[model samples]
Target: MYLRRKPIFFLFLLLHPVFINAQFFADRLKSFMSTAAVSAVQYPKEVKEFYELNSYRFSWLEKQNAEQLALLSDYIRSSPSLGLSAGDYHPEIFPIAAIHENDSLLTEISFTDAAIHFLHDLMMGNKAEPLSYDGLKYVPACYNAAALLNVYLSPGRFANLLTDLEPKEAGYLAVKTKLNAWLKITSAEKYEDVAVAVSKTLRGNKNGLTRLYQLGFVASDTASLSEPALKAALKEAQKMFSLLSDGELRSTTVQALNVPLATRIAELKNTLNTLRWLHCVKQERHVALVNIPSATLLLYEHGKLVIESRIIVGKKSTPTPTLSSTITEVILYPYWNVPYKIATRELLPAIKRNTGYINANNYQVLNSSGKVVDPYKVNWRSLSAGNFPYTIRQSTGCDNALGLVKLNFYNPFSVYLHDTPGKSLFGLDRRYFSHGCMRLEKAMELGRYVLTGNAVAIDTLTEKGCLKNQSPITVPATEKIPVFVLYHTAWIDGTGMLHFYEDVYNRFSPGRKP
Candidate 1:
């Protein structure tokens, strides 16, 4: 017993240092968190009182602005934990800055839309550091002021907002600046109370033929939409329509609505009414692929999922056929397989540039039907452009258009994932450029993401489509991955707010008013 006790005592002595260090680290983390909480508690009231008196004083709330001051005092007191601070929460500065500068018209738009959008985007998983600074530093003061400005500046587009001013702009903008964008969205008033009423007002402003014309425009463009977001927007619009009576919208009493502005507004609203409420703003915390409107691919990295990424998709006309797809494989140094369209359309033209266009590019032509045609016997130019048979294949080398990688997926459409030389387009808001094949922005990382049980490999394929290789429809991979192209502009998020994005495609979808 004594011998066993001696050994146990020795072991504890050996382990004691590690246990004490862990406890120390744990205490350090707790101390920092506690300190952060304390710091956050200090200055929100100063922020709130400051926000209200300056912006809402002239609006409808002006008659009672002073009476309402104490109501926000409690909220103002709790704001530090909310991240409001001095060199910090100078609330109205952002919009005023834009207004004062006059250069950033985009920011000139009611800052709440942008601010709320930014917050929602952050919550949905976008990087939030820049937004955090802007929100805390610029939004509180900017919120009500910007809301007033959005209505004031674009009355034609935002006339209904005059009613929204009733709610405390400080509370509204607080949600906008402090919360994530997704959460702010769900903060909308009940649909029947707000959405239906707005729709009725906008629609009532128009006459019959104009309304039909608007619906006609919506029906014509459903083709541009990919599922889910469009479907959801349509759902919300229809519901909003039913909530208000036809008479309410068409009441002959509303005189100004009968003007041309009302007609256009009605048209846009009618089209907007068709959008459905799909699962957008993925607060569901899903890891699925998201397609964007205006026809681009978005990978929801964080909560808001609005990162501008580059992708090469099918070209227009012979345009990469549009359809839903998921990412499945990542290949390095991908060999280019001259697409059937490219083989027939582009190769011959290149050969004219030089017979070597084929030999030099590692591409060889096939003849009349499906058989390989000799480059020697055919009068390449005289051949009818439409009926030409051969295929082109390139032997692998450095000049391959596919560049260093490929991400492949299975789609009935014969479309696959690949890399491109154009790296610049990824940063654009509109990324509709591509030829049926999907291009990746982070090829290497995406490749590693989808790779399966194979040797954790990063191998490159050298069989350039320019060569004489078998033109198999499917390149059997040792593994497959899941990649999808989705379009989600709004939905209840983790915080349960309906987040919205710009209807980039404008395809039969609109951000239905809250």
Candidate 2:
């Protein structure tokens, strides 16, 4: 019994210093946390909770944590390439020379605070500014500080964790590469603003030629070129600006060319932020993205672009909203149920003027009981916008407002993607003529893509003749495809060329500088 007791006593003696050191660290942390200075920590609550979870142990000060500390410092310093400000991580407070000093506790806490803040920004967006447009809802991935720290502290995980968190989408990576290149170029040289005379043609303007040369649109600035060569260069510039490539310089093209380089950089940064907010798309198998500013629709399957189409969005008075939803069904030979506002305010005047207008346009007037009524019998002149109570719907045919097909999705905005009879609108450089819904140039293609296995159904409906269809045929989606209606003024094309577009909605702040 005496020998066993002696062994237990020796074990206790050996463990005494470990317990005492833990208590000492806990007491110091508690005292410091109670002071007002702790409030200066960016994430004080997370920091305290982290230490408490580890029994008040010093994590960054531990010798084994040196690798992760160095990696984190590198990531923080290089964060600008990710469209994040390194200063936000408090890099100046990193304690490289104070590991053995008496103020090491403060240094530990500061480093921990920086790590938490950096991880938070990496997982979620920096959210430095509110989105310019309303009705844009995108929620990024989320993770707590304690959980992220545990993963970072684990063996052989720091680098892999970062790689996982970073966006791997081709579009995002292309923009990031361009942003880094621009940052280096801007730091090395001051870009001179190109001045273009609006009254003169850019074909013969020396300044315009130099600007085109600088932008790599033309081969040479000093050498004299023929009129055809100059026109071609102007067309290239127009294409880069996502304008009409008509080989003629217009006032709208002049505005794009005169956009300052610094403003372009700011636009790139805003694009990065927008992409980060939409990070959830990486996990999806199929996605349809509509960029309103560019008036383009891109369909992706298994992370590859499957289709690209031109789309007509809403006009200025009724701008299309940015939202995320899933396409659930496709309607063939769909009827257009004109909204109450459009029916009352827009079509009412025409109907009153011409009693035969409704039948000429294939529009039917339905009363409260859902029965068709003769438009000629109704008192059209007596019905004002406020007093009109009938539902106006267009019949199914090639001439229907929603031509051939319609893609249905649930959104509070009551907007959906559909085919339009105005095929000529797709040829325009800027197509924003819709009321609020999106008008698709290739609605049948999109319908088939969403209904992958049942694509023959679309062909069958179309072959049966549009005028013969009495009612809309609905095809439920086997797998609902996600759709994101976005607004980006700057984006990198597949060829790695960056394209800038007009801020159609005036979403960017006025008088903003880099």
Best by TM-score: 2
Clashes of 2: 0
Where does the lowest 10-residue lDDT sum fall in candidate 1? 129-138
Q: What overall lDDT, based on C-alpha atoms, would model 1 receive against the true structure?
A: 0.37
lDDT of 2 by residue, 1-514 (tens): 0111223223432333222355677788777777777777888988888876777776655545556666666777667777888888766664244233456667778888888887777666677334333332545554676667865677887766667777677778767776776676556565575676564455568888876765566777687887788878888878878988877767877787776666777788888876666555634678888888888888877657777888999998988888778899998888899999899878999998997989889999999988999888899989998898899999997789988889998888889999988999999878889988999988888998888899888889767756733699899986788788877789755443667777887877463321
Clashes of each: 81, 0
Q: What is the lDDT of residue 472 in candidate 1?
A: 25
TM-score of each model, in listed order: 0.38, 0.78
lDDT of 1 by residue, 17-50 (tens): 2222334433443343333332332232332232
Question: How good is model 2 by TM-score?
Answer: 0.78
lDDT of 2: 0.75
Worst 10 residues of 2 by lDDT: 1-10
lDDT of 2 at 32: 78
